[model samples]
Target chain A: MIETTQLTKRYGNLTAVDGISFKVEPGQVLGFLGPNGAGKSTTMKMIAGFLAPTSGGAKVCGYDVESQPIEAKRSLGYLPEGAPSYGEMTPRAFLEFIADVRGIAGDARKRRLDDVIGRLQLEGVLAQPIDTLSKGFKRRVGLAQAILHDPPVLILDEPTDGLDPNQKHEVRALINAMSHDKIIVISTHILEEVHAVCTRAVIIAGGKLLADATPAELETRSRYHGAVSLTATNTGEARAALARVADIESIEIDPQDHRITAFPKKGRAIFVAVSDALKAQNVTVSELALEAGRLDEVFRTITQPQIKGGRA
Target chain B: MNPIATVFRRELKGYFATPVAYVFIVIFLILAGSLTFYFGGFYERGQADLSAFFIYHPWLYLFLVPAIAMRLWAEERKSGTIELLLTLPITMFQAVLAKFLAAWAFVGIALALTFPIWITVNYLGDPDNGVIFTGYVGSFLMAGAFLAIGSCLSAATRNQVVAFILTVVACFLLLLAGFPLVLGFFQTILPQGVVDAISGLSLYAHFDAISKGVLDLRDIVYFVLTIGAWLYATAIVIDLKKAD
Candidate 1:
């Protein structure tokens, strides 16, 4: 298991990761969801033993990242932000160097190298210099290197940023397939990708985690209070009837279409009560359905834009 | 293979994989060879010795070695590859040693390519090959010294051009410390022992002794210790600047 206790990183006066704590169990795929500059990359780097946390601690397996860095790092495979690599070396050469450094030798090294080469499908450009390859190819090569040692824990930062649709699917499939054995934590700003490859997501904004749950649980949490759209024969009458239902926050009518929308505090109860109450008002209920909250909406709702004069 | 050896093998090949290595070797050889033969008056001395060749190596290396060593860490920092290399399981010392050896070996290759000059001297006269060998050894050690300084400077800056310029200036001053013009400037103001101590620290003075086949333990120790000291500083600088 991976655990952090009040882990924080401060640069001068600005806190990048502000006393946040979380955990990832074995065989779990955790998504680090955040907008740009949300401290996702900083937290990942700190966990990977690349950046020293300003306070508190992060532990990988059972080893402390700051004190037992070599041990912690040995069990972790990290693809740092931007996937930086040596431009002068070929993919094969770079991977070989990384394998050697990781102490994989002889047949084991070759076998693992072949496995990653095949998995990432880097055969065509294995011999090509990294500088000469396209961005997608370079990203694949970076991924191949990250998994070369098959470390038990994987921390990938924006792993599919440069991939095309087909390649993204393949990479997501690879991530899904590998999640059964490794503790994988992937950070990305793409909301759809969270559902695509993640089992649980930890969403952070303004350097503080706002939500942590299974994908389904998070979905439910965001939709707990949802908007319900209803069209009735008498729109104004339906609006008045729905407002009387328990937990119904507000109701608005569209004059042109004679349709009304209701935002309820308790989505499930209000949906039933509003539909029942509208019928009691002798209003023909044309449409009454609870809109499921999307990950995009949750991302926006939970992320409070930093305020300057309350404009945001 | 040992990890250091493995790193060395990869790094050694890294030099040949690009035009920078070849260009550096060719330019270094041409400049060193021309300076030794033309400016140092190799044939005019006509004493069946390699003093002329050995005398100019310090000045040549002041510029050429920095050109070779400027990219050792600076390029890694600029291209963001240092993150990849350093994050591996190896210690910083091993990485630093591997890269330093790769660059020094490239200089060694360029130095070796000047074998034709050795062959020419041998064919022309009964030159003392032992002295010539020692001179080559001194030259290589001095090259390492200059490279260590350049490597440290390279780690200090992200821009390769800035690294090159700073290394050149630092190395030029180290070389000129032994010149009469510089010593005379110091002689008027400083105590005689202080002037002597300053000049004694010059590469030309220690290298001059080694090139004459003296094999003084002190000179050998100075070069090795100088390389070690600067490389230790390089490691520290790397740690300080590494991204958080």
Candidate 2:
């Protein structure tokens, strides 16, 4: 379990994380969302016992990160950004070093080492220096070290940042495989990751917590929620037909493509009624789609104000 | 195994993982051999004692020890491994002491390989082996001093070049404190007691006493305290500037 009570970090004049609080229970995979400098990394550092919080505190498995750092760290596994490891060491040696520090020894150490190496497909680069490997292999080496000891809480900062699509899917599957028993926190800007893998997410910007909810809840807050869009002859007749639907609140037509869109009143689903209206008016709808809403839209609505208002 | 032992073994092996260990050992042997033969007149003195060998250690270490110590923390910081290290279930002091011990032991290995000189001296004539042993101890202690300084300076920056330069300059000042050139400047403004105190802080004087065939408890304590103080400062520096 991991919990932060108003955790904050300040570097001289700039506040990187301002009094943010949340808890990650066992079996919960929380995706940390933010723009650049959103304090996601800072918060992860605090929980990992790498960076001291300027105020407030974090606890890992009930151990206070600042006061009981060793205990807190014993329960936590952290993969720093860029997956830094000893470049001179081969993947085998680096994992052995991490296993030693993590107190995995003898037969258990070998078993865990082989397990992660096999799972991450690190056998090809097992003897090669980490610096000589490609970026994806380097990331796998880091991931192997992180899960070598199998600690209770894992804080991965951008686990899939530089991975290709297939590698990203494999890593996501790995995280999903571990999510049933571990407390995993992943900080990322790739919003689709949250919808795909996160059980919950917290959006932070300008060092402040903007929203904390499940991916489903956040999607509902988008302006496109329950709205309908159709390309049924973007002509005036189609626009009037879309506007006359009972539950349809407004009709917006794209002048360039002549596509008609209908927004429901009070965020209700008006897809059936609008579809029926188009049929009754003899307007053949080519493409009719209803939105559960887009996470990108919600993310833009939550983060764009800071960019416009000039938070700096 | 203890975490310190774990860290120490990995780091010690890391020295050999690249060309660093071979280069350092080769350079050290060449310098120790050449300096003893040319400057100390090992052949001309016709003496079996290793004074010629031990005499130039402080100067050799003035350059070489920093080369070994500059990468102790600087490389970790530059590569971002320090974050993974400090976040492990180990204390700052443990990490600092482990790296220092690894470097010290590495230097010890280089020093031990100089045993051929001892064999050469003993084969030539009767020599005071007891004094020679003390000379090795003194050399190791002085290397520890230089290494401690290097370790502390290396923790202050991520750039290895900057760390190396700062360590050389800092150790140079410490060494110069006991020299007449610096003392002459200080004596103009300072009193006799302060001058004596500054002179008492000399690595030259303590290394001199041990190299001259006497093992003073005071010299041993000086090296111990110096290594301890600098290592403690290293721990504090890592804690303070590690995030940078």
Candidate 3:
């Protein structure tokens, strides 16, 4: 439901969103991942029609954001960074205002307002001023405003930023429930959020799209650079015995724990051979398992190193 | 009604939903009453004209209108709500006009609260109430002109303090453009025709004509065109800074 061309956003000398193109089809929960100053928010803003791209264009539901902004914007709901809200208004009042602006009137307005408020669990604090509420509560109110219109496309920037664990779960569940009908692009720097919620992941670093893949694929890529561990009672015996195993890249002994950790490309087979060799040596194996790479590891390895270099 | 009216109603009600409308009305009534009776010298001048009341409005609005208008778009930018607002189905022109009209209507409500002064003037003498009524029209128009400029300036800055200061500076320049100090400075540098044209652009001149009970078409057109020009400028500024 959303497509971007060679979209680029430049602020004087800095290119915030550098010529990155991506598409989000309907019913896809696309997790937009990037570190700070990575242009995830800038890309989302361009797609939402809030910012005009410097070089290319973005389209929402087939309507070009620059040429047909009103139609494109009408089809999308955006929750901006920091979850901006009018502090003087209550949650109920703010949602009502958004409903009014969205042109949902009469029973539809009332029903949608009821649904969002109830789903966000904002009943108790609905009447309290937003400025008086906690940050988490305020974020819920922002979420309520975003989904009140129930647009077909949803672009949420840092949707679960300040929420406690329970509130985050509620928001995640709400997003998961709505994933069937909307094209949701959630921009966040949290790796665990991608694995937990997103159907697809797009990793961006230094204002460029670095990788686009599924969580499993990213983890598989992590495995290409990972190691397997083998822990035993006597590290010296285990290491010497496992030395005969093929593809045993390196071995390290932990002096305190007396554990032998092995680095191997064929993680599982090499671990199995090390286990058999240690068994032959009469060395009791305490822990012998292939360490599967995690999405967090992949995220750090792919995005963090480039961020350190501050490269474009 | 147009969809613009829908936006207008919501925006207008936003002011009343909080303490802004009530406080503005109450304070305006008290000050207007005091000005007409004691400070404006309505009875001491012993005149049927409401020049006393209308004369003080431009100065009163110099500060009051900015307080009402400083949040038109500045607060929206500061709070990050402008994105949500602009993404609605409404066009930018509609949103700009709706916001401007809402603020203008608010100033109208505050102006309407000064009716007790009108009632007092009517009760006291055979005043030309038509002249007084027309004077209010001119004052309302002038207030709208001031508000339009303030709204445009507010859209340019995120800080309300900066918006207020810039608005005061802009309105002050318009107010003093035709004054003797400014005119004297311009007489040496500018031709007489250009100087006359510049002085005619002053809001104070046309407003003064209407306050004297003269309903010249040119004076009415002047206020309308000035308001329209500033509002159009406001729409352009908003479109330029859409991201904020």
Candidate 4:
């Protein structure tokens, strides 16, 4: 388990991380969602024992990070921001150094090294220096180093930030593969990533925790939840027909795509009602979708108020 | 393996991974050889000792040792590898000590490579090998003191050039504290006891004693304490400035 109680970090006058408390159990992947400079990295750094908190503390597997740093750190694997590593060393040599530092020795060390190398597909670049590797390869090497010993608690800061689409999918798959018994915490600004891998997500803005819930639960907060959107041939006729539906509280036309979206009243399902109404109006429907929710809209609604408040 | 040994091994190997180790060793050898022969007048002294060689060590190390130590923490901070290093299951003291020992051992290798000069001195005439050995010990100890200072200063900044310049200035002041020109100026203005106390803090005074064949216990303790105190400061500095 990884638990942080009222953790805070301050830099002179600026409070970078406010008093934030949360806990993660095994078999759960927690996504830390925040805007840029919202203290996501600082919180991760504190949890990993890389930065001392100004107030409160973190515990990994019941070991206090500040008082029992070695014990806590031994059970934790961290990939710091930017996936920093010794650039001069080859991936093979760098992994060996991390292995030695982690105290994985003898045949076990070799097995672990080979396992991670194969898992991350680093066999081809094992001999090349990390400095010469591409960003994606470097990120893989960083992930390889973190998982070499297979620590129970893994904290990655923006794990898929710089990856291409395929690499992002692979990394998300890797996270899923490892989420069976590990408490994995990954921080990212990408909203879709929360849906991609996170079992639970905590959104923060201006160094304050705004919301914490499962991705599905968080998505339900979106205004688009249970809403139906359709692209119709006769958009005006479709809008006129949908005006008569009692369940839909409002309707909007997307300026960019000319798709009409009808929002349902609280706790109402209008997919069937809207479909029937459109069919009766003889509307030519090209596409229709009952959105689970738009995570980006919910994210903006939850965090934008804080930004406006800060500016004012 | 223990974290210190692992980190030390990695740090030592890191120097060799680039052109740094080979270049540093080559430059150190060349400077040590020429300074002893051309500047120190080893031939004109006509003595069967390496006094000419040992005399120029402090001056040579002033520039070269800092070159080695400046990159110790500065490069880690620049490349953002300090976060990776510190987050590993290792104490700050272990990291600082391991890096220092690795750099010290690297300098030791460079110092040992001057064996041909020792052989040449022995070939010329019979010399006190014990004095030569003490001189080597003294030079190594002095190098450690310089390295410890450099390590602390390197932790204070992410820029290697700034670390290098600061370390050079700090080490130069320590060396100058024992110079006759500096001491003579203090003697006229200050009381004898104060002057003596000031000179006692000089690295030159302690190293000079050891290089002249007298391996005083006090001199050894001075170097050890200097290394210990500065390494302690290094850990503290890293803690305070690492997040910046």
TM-score of each: 0.90, 0.96, 0.92, 0.98
Worst 10 residues of 2 chain A by lDDT: A303-312
TM-score of 1: 0.90
Candidate 1 lDDT, tens digit per residue, A1-312?
Answer: 799999887777677788889999988999998777788888887898767888989999899988888788788888877788878888999998889878898899999999999998889988889999988888888888889999899999999897899888988999998999899999998888998999999988767787898777777766433667777776667767776787777666676886677767653456677767877888787777775557877787777563111100
2 versus 4: better TM-score goes to: 4
lDDT, candidate 4, residue B143? 97
Give model 2's DockQ, 2 decimals. 0.85
Tens-place lDDT digits, model 2, residues A1-312: 899999988888878888999998999999999888777888898889998999999999999999999999988889998889999999999999999888888899889998999999998989999889999899989888888888889999999999999989999999999999999999999998997789999998888899999998998998778888889754777887776777877778787887776889995789889888889899877898987788998998998775422121
Fnat per model, in the order shown: 0.56, 0.86, 0.61, 0.95
lDDT of each residue in A20-134, candidate 3, tens digit only: 9998899899999877878888898888887778999999999999999888987988898988887877898888878877778999989999999888999999889899999
Candidate 3's displacement at residue B238, Å, is: 3.0
List of clashing residue pairs for candidate 1: none
Chain B TM-scores of the candidates: 0.95, 0.96, 0.94, 0.99
**Top candidate (lDDT):** 4
Candidate 1 residue lDDT tens string, B159-206: 889999999998888878878899999999999999999898887778
Where does candidate 3 chain A have its weakest 10-residue lDDT segment?
Answer: A303-312
| Each prediction's whole-model lDDT (CA) | 0.84, 0.90, 0.84, 0.94
Q: Per-residue lDDT for A15 in model 2?
A: 84
How well does candidate 3 reproduce the true complex, by DockQ?
0.57
